[model samples]
Target: MGHVTFFGVVTFVFRHSAGCTGNAISSPHRCILVPSFEIKGKNSMPKMYRTKLAAMVKNFPRYASANQPPNGEIRSYIESAGHTCELRDAGEFQSPADVVNLVSEHPKFEAALAIHLFKAGRLLMDIEIPFGVIFGGTDINEDVKVEQKRVVMEQVLLKARFAVAFTDKLKEEAELFLVSQSSKIYVQPQGIQTDVTEKFCWTEFLRSSGVRTEHVDELRVFLLVCGLRRVKDPLYLVEVFSKWHCENLLNVLVIIGPKIDPVLTAEVETVVKRTAGVFLAQERCQQELHAAMKRCFAVVNSSVSEGMSAAILEAMDLGVPVLARNIPGNAAVVQHEVTGLLYSSPQEFVRQSQRLLSDHELRERVVRNGKLYVEEHHGVKQERETYQRLVDTLH
Candidate 1:
């Protein structure tokens, strides 16, 4: 793919025999040409530009902590492109010399890709590697606001051969910091395994979470699946539900995800202890989570910030309508009043939740639309093709 800058708008020229063209018209932008291409073969994989590749991650467990939709998906795609992909835990490296030594041990690796630029825990300035930097949510969204973290991130962005973000929003946000190097930013959506089936045992979830099956039938449950971190705002629903529970409503709110932050975990624990309707459980396996979402009335996302929410997407895929924070990331997935409702305040959320619970027709409509939206937009096939295009350009 070749990119051309015309009057400040960046247009991509895709290589194909039967070329297609389109435009992205935004405010301060018009007549921006986007060329498309006809794929030549059915099994077309990107030509590998580098023979060997290394992936540097922060904490192996933390990097793989929350469901790594894009990272895991792209790793498979990269490997399929005929490059040797090796994983490195930068958490083991204490200093710049340690990073250099780790890279030195893998001399055969021609290029490296840092998954989380800042969290990789290596002084990249002193490490010599032909590497590209992939910015996670923290690097561009949170770290960039801090002067020191921004400086380090800026160096990584400036020195990297290319950069990757999970969404176009993140790509545009990346331009604010690394405006001159905008050409290197690629838009790749995370991929999910689409072979979802409703054949899982709900009893397994009950046993794993220590909640008896009797309690399941006693409450109308709403599940919020996300890591217990401050950014996720897991307690937002807890506070609202606590108030609602006093009304003698037969409803329960289950918050399930890995406890990432100890402080936030304690806060969630306190809320769970005090709140009658709220239940906190350890993160369940993916299949179990899917089954849980299938059984629930609706899914909720209360993230203060997000790139693209995999939890919300998975819920939509399972034909569950979502009630999400009225923010960019959630809005990108949930079309307000169509697929789901968005709220900025606790009052608005409670109102929406009550409405969704009471109105079966509205709930069915949203669920139908959300299912269609996910199938069309966030399907695994679409993501795989997008990655193929991105990797094709690497050569």
Candidate 2:
């Protein structure tokens, strides 16, 4: 997309042509003109400018341990747009001043992107480069409710050239605090692509996770993938799930993800060890994890909050049904009983799960609908185009 500049403000010029060759930028309000420059070299190679991505990174063991898979996917999309990105741990910085110092030290970077308002976005405020904040689940769902955090977050939002929310509901929540900049906030769901290991062995994976050999033939695994964190509520249905398994002799709940919180990891270990039909699988890369997810009966999300879960979308893309908590985030994506099942309480969760398992027609219908939803709304190509346009607009 062609961008125009007026006194250092970036404004995109929209064109109407069948063969338009640039990105189509979308915003909640009118585009502003800003100082703009070319991001290409004489030889036609896309000019490379460093882009810093600030986010949490402590517990994950996969690529760029501090950033989650969604961040990784975003990074890849940014690179595809011809930019170099460096991930800085938002959790490691002690204060906003520290974040400013870090960005100032990297003079080559043209812009910045921060994930989550309180931890990531707060630090990047007052920095020289034009920065945007991508709202994480807690940013709108919990942190905005805190007076102290809400104050800092509002400041960040005002300073930011733009802000991103994964859903319209999340954008509305952010607008409740950032009333003035509601026009700068855009709703864009995370994109997803599911790929599994070529040589995955379902029987071996089941055996390794402690499923009984005799029961493997009839085992109906319900995979719960999340880091061992309090917000995830990974063990929410463990006790009841174990009881159901004992009675049914086929149901099992397997929890898998990185050990993000040490204290929660210990708690999960203790609870999972004592609970029957509940196994804690080791953390694996996204590809391997998706492989395991495909071998299961369904995927369960018990998170207290979510910023448009990549895992849930991936499950849908992989043709797996989802059973998620009835929170605003999940509810926004899942059309309860059509795309997936949504539960408001533990008892409701068990009842819904039972219904999902017993009714094959319901399961197939939900999975089919969920797959269609993911393809229509969360396609990777759409996400890449959106980010490319957003980045292109940065001064």
The model with the greatest TM-score is: 2
Per-residue lDDT for 193-291 in model 2, tens only?
777988787788777877765767578899998877777888888888888878877888999877767888899999988998899887777678889
lDDT of 1 by residue, 1-395 (tens): 11110000011111111121222111010011110100001335533232344454432322213323344454454554444445544444466575455444412333455655565422445655455555556556766788787777777677766666777877777788643578877776665553344676665665555444466565666778777777788888677677887684566778887766788889888868767767776665566677788888778888887767777777777888899999877777778889888999977988998999789998998999988887776666666666445434433
Q: Which residue pairs clash in candidate 1?
A: none
lDDT of 2 at 21: 28
Which parts of model 2 are misplaced by more than 4 Å? 1-69
| Candidate topping lDDT | 2
What Cα-based lDDT does every candidate model obtain? 0.58, 0.65
TM-scores of the candidates are 0.79, 0.83
Model 1 segments more than 4 A misplaced? 1-50, 57-68, 121-123, 195-199, 207-215, 385-395
Error of 1 at 78 (Å): 2.0
Q: Which ten residues in a row have the lowest lDDT in candidate 2?
A: 34-43
Model 2 pairs in collision: 1-23, 5-34, 8-35, 9-33, 9-34, 9-35, 10-34, 57-66
In model 2, what is the error at residue 73, expressed in angstroms? 2.0
